[model samples]
Target: MNEIIPRYIYGFLNSGLLLIKYCRSCTVCSRLTRFPRYNDPKKLVETREGRCGEWANCFTLYCRAFGYESRLVAPYGVLTLILDFTDHVWTECYSQFLGRWMHLDPCEAIYDRPLLYEKGWNKKLNYAIAIAKDGVYDVTKRYTRKWHEVLSRRTMVTEPSLSSILTNITNETRRGFAPQLLSIIEARDIEENQQIERSLHSEDDESLSLPGRRSGNEQWRKSRSEIGSDNLSSSACPVRLCVDEHVTKIYNAFRPVLHQFIAEEVTKAEAVE
Candidate 1:
């Protein structure tokens, strides 16, 4: 078992208090500007809202910043129950100890909800569960023509790049660390360290800028090359229109189970400590 997985889970679970405080107190907005069209990597970070509302992004970033392998999961839009909408994102961690994947609902934790199982889950949901249990779930019933379409939509869309993922992680970590570091410096009357901290933060801000970052561009180009020429035109793809439908199905199918798993894990961790 790789030592990092447990450490990430521990770090994530333990950082709940700090995460909440930062989310509440920070003035930064969380809206993504390059939404609706998930393909343009350039527009990804141009959000007016701070990072607080985007807890999944923050959590994924945190895990990656700590060197834990993580990925974002979303539902296919087809299975929403009445009055339920289905655009959501979550994080999954690759656990070496369990030799599988583990789902981490950072957004849910911030919002104070347990993970649950939704009916008619999509590939992401199934992937998340498989990680959680360290085994595959019965995805047979869930697979359908519509579900395949959902998978196709994801494949067609631009998947997040390693650089973007890392940048997000870096932003979240700096955000998480800044206030605490400031508080510590304030406590110790460490005047000299303040200057050093400012310089470090300035560097971080420049590095995180998406425009000049070669790594982000490289990743975007790499993804484009992998997708080949088929279905490059978003307008030609019916999968985009059907995405919401598939997402609804996934949410309805697995919400309950996910909620329970999160609750139990939190409880066990608390008891152990």
Candidate 2:
């Protein structure tokens, strides 16, 4: 239903298929944002273009404005070969379905697919944290394979030190709230942490599900690189570039699906595009 903002966020992502090319070009760098923040969804809606963080920030802002709770999440440590965890950002909105907050990546137009990185992309996950108005949340369990592997990353900060840091940051971030509510938020954070601890300790939660296909293959990675270069290859004749046959077909196939989803949602509200 339109009432669920996560769906709207997901739908908006699907509608804004601009993230596809953006990811290919800018995933390796944050510097691209400086050229233009792409921070305004209004502009992105009009232009139909933006990178991953732009998609995340815009979605976060839109969700908050539309009366839904939201947060921006980023992985904290270990973007190594084993972890293969890249520095990425996404929005998380409170979900009525799972009765807990869920992950929403606009870049991939994926909803509740934290495991997509570990399982689908066949990458490792370490520490991921969410920064929201109410409090800081450790949401790593939703993505990781080996809990023990993340222990060192978690140890980067002691419990007491991390608590103090989060408390101070929360006060600064959520200062507009009534002073009386700070303690309430703090209590909620503590409870959520305890819940996460129990959930992560469960035997079933230790390993992520494997991918059906052998993931992160060299050929697949190379194909993705070609996909990112806007399907055109740099040849000896720089001006005379050749387009990859597969990329055009794939993009054309996916483009219509993205447009249809966006159109359905737009019919319900004023559309920027």
Candidate 3:
């Protein structure tokens, strides 16, 4: 269901389908064009089209309906946009295969590309929060490699205060839930955060070479500074020699022990002689 839902949503929402932008009292309006953004899934089904906001909203609802644990991922603070309403929005469905939430953007028909916004589009993201059934999570770290830059941009609230706010919201949302369930959720959150840290620090060249935003027009993406740079070569990315480093560390740590063992063997030999 997780694999099928985004493609299912994307199947009908192609370029041919047009969103109603300008409709008059009983006819069509020509001068000004602005339509109320629909949040309800039922209304979205009727309209059959919208931007990222509507796409994410409907996709998340469908995922929940199909018994998949999912969440609507969106930015928390103010987003200064050249076009569109918010920075970007997408869905993250908990993947049984990986035992973690995977990014699923129906708009792009892209999955597991959490770095799309930051790396692909070349956008500076401040906060990316996941609004789940159990609670909300400040998942900004999962999406960006330049985490220090993202941190510097987060001037709206202090880290502790932001954490407090999210905790409060989550507690309120998780009210009446079993203590055991809450504990499980908290453990999952910690594990996920650790996983995100590992992923952000990953030295995978494939991740580093991910292309620019594939959904929007070239001009629009360029305007938003999202049209990511061309494929990065191995020379440019320079994969870290962690294996060599680890071996060297092990040798350094055990060198003294090896010398002591050799000295003990020689001393026993001298005594025997």
Candidate 3, residues 118-226, lDDT tens digits: the string is 7677777898888887888888888887888999999988999999999999999999999999888889888998999998897645535566665544555667676
Off by more than 4 A, model 1? 1-53, 78-85, 110-115, 119-273
What would the per-residue lDDT of candidate 2 be over residues 112-163, giving only the tens digit for each residue? 7666665555444566778786667667876664577766657677867876
Candidate 3 similarity to native, TM-score: 0.68
**Residue lDDT tens for model 1, 153-179:** 444234455236434544454464567
Clashes of each: 44, 0, 1
For candidate 3, the 10 contiguous residues with the lowest summed lDDT are 1-10
Question: TM-score-based ranking, best first?
Answer: 3, 2, 1
**Candidate 2 runs further than 4 Å off:** 1-47, 77-85, 96-98, 154-160, 205-273
**Model 2 TM-score, 2 decimals:** 0.54
Q: Report lDDT (Cα) of residue 173, candidate 1.
A: 44
